[model samples]
Target: MKNLVLTFLLTVITVGSVAAQEINWVTLEEALELQKKEPKKIMIDMYTVWCGPCKMLDKNTFQNKEVAAYVNENFYAVKFNAEGNDVVSFQGKEFTNPSYDPAKASRRNSSHQLSRYFQVNAYPTIVYLDENADLIAPIKGYQTPTQIELYLKMFANNDYKTLTTQDAFNEYYLAFKPEFKG
Candidate 1:
């Protein structure tokens, strides 16, 4: 009877841990709406269906237990498709992919207007926004857990504003001890 109870307890613990591993991904509009209520910074993951690096980011860095926990606590996480037909209402403007082709949905479709607005030249761009929903910076490409932790902490705490010069940024980069596991 004790062995059966232990097995049940272990199963419950494992299931709860697995459930907490996911990043709380919301839509662009949802993030903005949430910001109005809670006033948290926004972290947008701009990805494409045909991008390999985008998939890797989703599977690797974004899925890391520490990464998800930190991001969930710090920012309003958003998953935006750079080349999809989703209508995004941002900054009092309604943006959509007017040229989105349904036949090419799985491949390289036309870029969304919101993607153009951010001027995302590459896939897997991680765009950061202030609590006011203003653009901060867009870091392009795939990032490991440690690599992204730098940006995550910087943006979350508004440290990017103080690091004006490249030298200052370098100093901060060198001094910053990453807590996220890679």
Candidate 2:
């Protein structure tokens, strides 16, 4: 009886932990709508279907337990395909991929207007927006869990407000301690 009870308790704990570690990704429109009710900073994972580094980031960094938990808690995460057909409305404007070919959905298609709007010329750009849905920064390229953890914390904690100069940013970067194990 004691062993059975312990096993059931362990199973419940494990399931709950796994559930909590998941980053609840919502569509851009849904995120915007949710912000109207409960505001939070947004993090956009901008990527193309054919991008290799983007896949790596999704599999490695985004899947990391610490990365998933922090991003889930602090931001309304959006997985935006840069070259897909999804229409996103932002700042009183509607953006779409007019030239996106349906047959090449899994390959490289036309870039979405939102990607162009954010000037994302590369894959795996992490675009951060303030709680007011204003652009904070569009960081380009693939980042490890540890590398992204710093930016996540910086923006989440409003530490970016203090780093006005390049030197200040450098100092902040140098002093950042990464907690993401994966």
Candidate 3:
């Protein structure tokens, strides 16, 4: 009886942990739809299947409990395949991969039109959009949870609006303090 109770408690704990780690990911269209009802910023993880750094971002940063919680609460998170064949509608325009091949589904395929729209030249770019679905910024490369927290808070609090010049951003960076731990 004690062993049974212990197992049940451990199972419950594991389930809760998994739930916290999982981000509520939505498609670009779905995020736009959700925004129309309740306004929130959009965070798109633009990644290609063939990119190793992209996979690491998924396993390390996105899976972190603090990062996932903050993103799920403050933004509509999107996991967009930058090289996939999904058709995305953004700002009243349709975007797709005209050069996507089924044979290279798991390999390096052609860049999606939406990717070009964001000017994302590299893999694992985190694109943030404003509450009105306007472009905020694209943070390139693999970022740890602590590193990403800075931008996440900066945009969530609309700090980017005042940061027009490079000097302002540099000052902001110098004064900023990261709260998320690994």
Candidate 4:
């Protein structure tokens, strides 16, 4: 009886720890607040409920232990719904979809002004920003966990300031391998 109880307690503890490893995403405003205190960069997962690939990226790529750990350590991660109703305030401006149609649930609402501000034309766009909330770059499309680790490291290390072109960065990425274990 004692052994059984101890085993159950251990199992519960392990599961709790695993669950806690999941990313704790913040709102864009909250991220900006954090940025004022620290120099950490920001990573925004721009997603919509209807985007199939975005779902897959969340479940497969972002949920990976290594990916989650890296992102948590290096960035103020934000999960922004492209068509969400929330008003996002940035740079002394509020962005919302004033023309959104609630009747057409499947179709996207008028995009948040911030989406247009960042030129996010597609689903599953990953936008990285500097500590000052300036656009670093907007990465379009779904990326595997391994593929994304390169970008995480690049921005985390402030390597973008040195590289002159994407091709140069691509060359460096191809030559590099992640040190973090999944």
- Candidate 4 regions exceeding 4 Å error are 1-16, 180-182
lDDT of candidate 2 over 1-182, digit per residue (tens): 99999999999999988775678999988899989998999999999889999999999899888899899889999999999998778889989889989999989898899999888999999999999999999999999999999899999999999999999999999999998896
Q: List per-prediction Cα lDDT, in the order shown.
A: 0.93, 0.92, 0.94, 0.86
Stretches of candidate 2 exceeding 4 Å from the true structure: 1-20
Q: Tell me the lDDT of model 4 at 141.
A: 91
Question: Worst 10-residue stretch by lDDT in candidate 2?
Answer: 15-24
Residue-level lDDT tens digits of model 3 in 1-182: 99999999999999998777779999989999999999999999999999999999999999999999999999999999999999888898999899999999999899999998998999999999999999999989999999999999999999999999999999999999888989
The root-mean-square deviation over C-alpha atoms between each candidate and the true structure, in angstroms, is 2.8, 3.5, 2.3, 2.7
lDDT of 1 by residue, 1-182 (tens): 99999999999999998876889999888898898899999999999999999999999999898999999999999999999999878888999999999999999999999988987989999989999989999999999999999999999988999999999999999999998777
| Clash number by candidate, in order | 0, 0, 0, 0
Best-performing candidate as measured by TM-score: 3
Q: Can you write out model 4's per-residue Cα lDDT over 48-152, one digit (the tens) per residue?
A: 878999999998888888889889999999999887777888999989877777885566666777788888989899999988889998999998888888889
Model 1: colliding residue pairs: none
Ranking of models by TM-score: 3, 1, 2, 4
Q: Give the C-alpha miss distance for residue 153 in model 3, angstroms.
A: 0.4
In order of appearance, the predictions have TM-scores of 0.90, 0.89, 0.92, 0.88
